[model samples]
Target: MAGALDALWSQYTWALGNGDPRTDSWLLVHSPIPVTLLFVCYLLLVVAGPAVMRCREPLRLVGPLAAYNLGLVVLSGYIFYEMASVCWWCLFSKAIELLDTVFFVLRKKQEQITFLHVYHHSTMLFNWWAGVKFVPGGQAFFVGMLNALVHVFMYLYYGLACLGPRVRCHLWWKRHLTTLQLGQFVAIAVHSSYNLFAECPFPDGFNMAVLLYSLSLILLFLNFYYQTYLKGKQDKLT
Candidate 1:
């Protein structure tokens, strides 16, 4: 049994070594343990955070939330800019994004902590870990760049909305954010699908993974849009 475990561990390390050499020395890319541990901690917090806040008043984080969202807008832009030049930063950005859920928990915005929210946040970390681990650049950069671009606008809206009623009143394109997100998924799916079929240098496996993941996001976001906007409108009219 010990020999078998040793062989399994050797295979895992060999797989890690097979990835982009440029990112081999980079943080969190050396082993899956760091990201896996972070993921586990995120799950633990998701379960424990709200429970811990049950008795306490929800923390008012208007200023900090505004800052956090705006910060991500800047970070996302930087990632878009540096995407082709380096891939590690994009991987690092995923770890930073995990804070989104933490903030939701802290603010006691239980409604915002939906399964879609948790799934998206948690999965991106692992997905990108694999992306950076292997096939760091090439077609993978397309998805990262497009996602970063969408995040710029998305975070800008959220940051402005956090400034209270006056700011939010001007932010009339709230529903449009969901539309934009859906559009992003569509674009990514198309891009990934094309590369999967084309004679591209990027790994077929990664392209397929991206294609499937984007399709899943499309379905989930469509349901969210129906529930939040379309159905809500119908109910209001009734």
Candidate 2:
């Protein structure tokens, strides 16, 4: 069982050019054919798997779900600790972290994937890709740690959401989830900005891009919260 879970993670981890890949170009870094195939599979699963579940009696793998969520938290925490200790591998890990959204898709839950999702998913991979290619051991570590802690909470919500309405009432933190998500971006921007100006090895260009990108996400999420949760009288969360 452990081996199988490791294999699942390896499948995804190996797909993202090992994050700290030897090369920069996608073609030369690794087997694009295999990696692209796996990435496409992930994208398809997220985009289409939900509809399939709605059609097919709702597939449930609570055990894997639990492990995946908590396991990622542990992994992210370790990486964060490593970053804080010395080596900052968050940039590379974030590259492979493109798979984070797989959690939302598998549960047939659209509620978790919001505008924040689009922005984060779309750019996190690219930004981390840039960081890995350009900024080796960049300050992305701080951001990754913050993100992991948030995921501890986010995936806990996901794990409970998987319990199907029996535990749905406990998922009351959706509004705060958005707030927390927004907070993550703010923290990322602030920290990354500080690292940019402070004595650092990473390039200012990388810092600007990531910080700006995260800021854009913050604004988008704030607007989303106001419209979805705050503006509405009733809780329309899913």
The best candidate in terms of TM-score: 1
Candidate 1 structure quality by residue, lDDT tens digits, 118-217: 9999999999999888878888888899999999999999899888998888998989999999999999999988887788888787888889999999
Cα error of candidate 2 at position 144, Å: 2.1
Model 1 spans > 4 angstroms off = 1-11
Q: Which is the leading candidate under lDDT? A: 1
Q: C-alpha displacement of 198 in model 1, angstroms? A: 1.0
- Cα lDDT tens digits, model 2, 42-88, are 56766776777676554466777766666666666676566554232
Backbone clash pairs for candidate 2 read: none
Steric collisions counted per model? 0, 0
> TM-score of predicted model 2?
0.67
Candidate 1, residue 222: the lDDT equals 98
Provide the global lDDT of candidate 2 against the true structure.
0.64
TM-score of 1: 0.94
TM-score of each: 0.94, 0.67
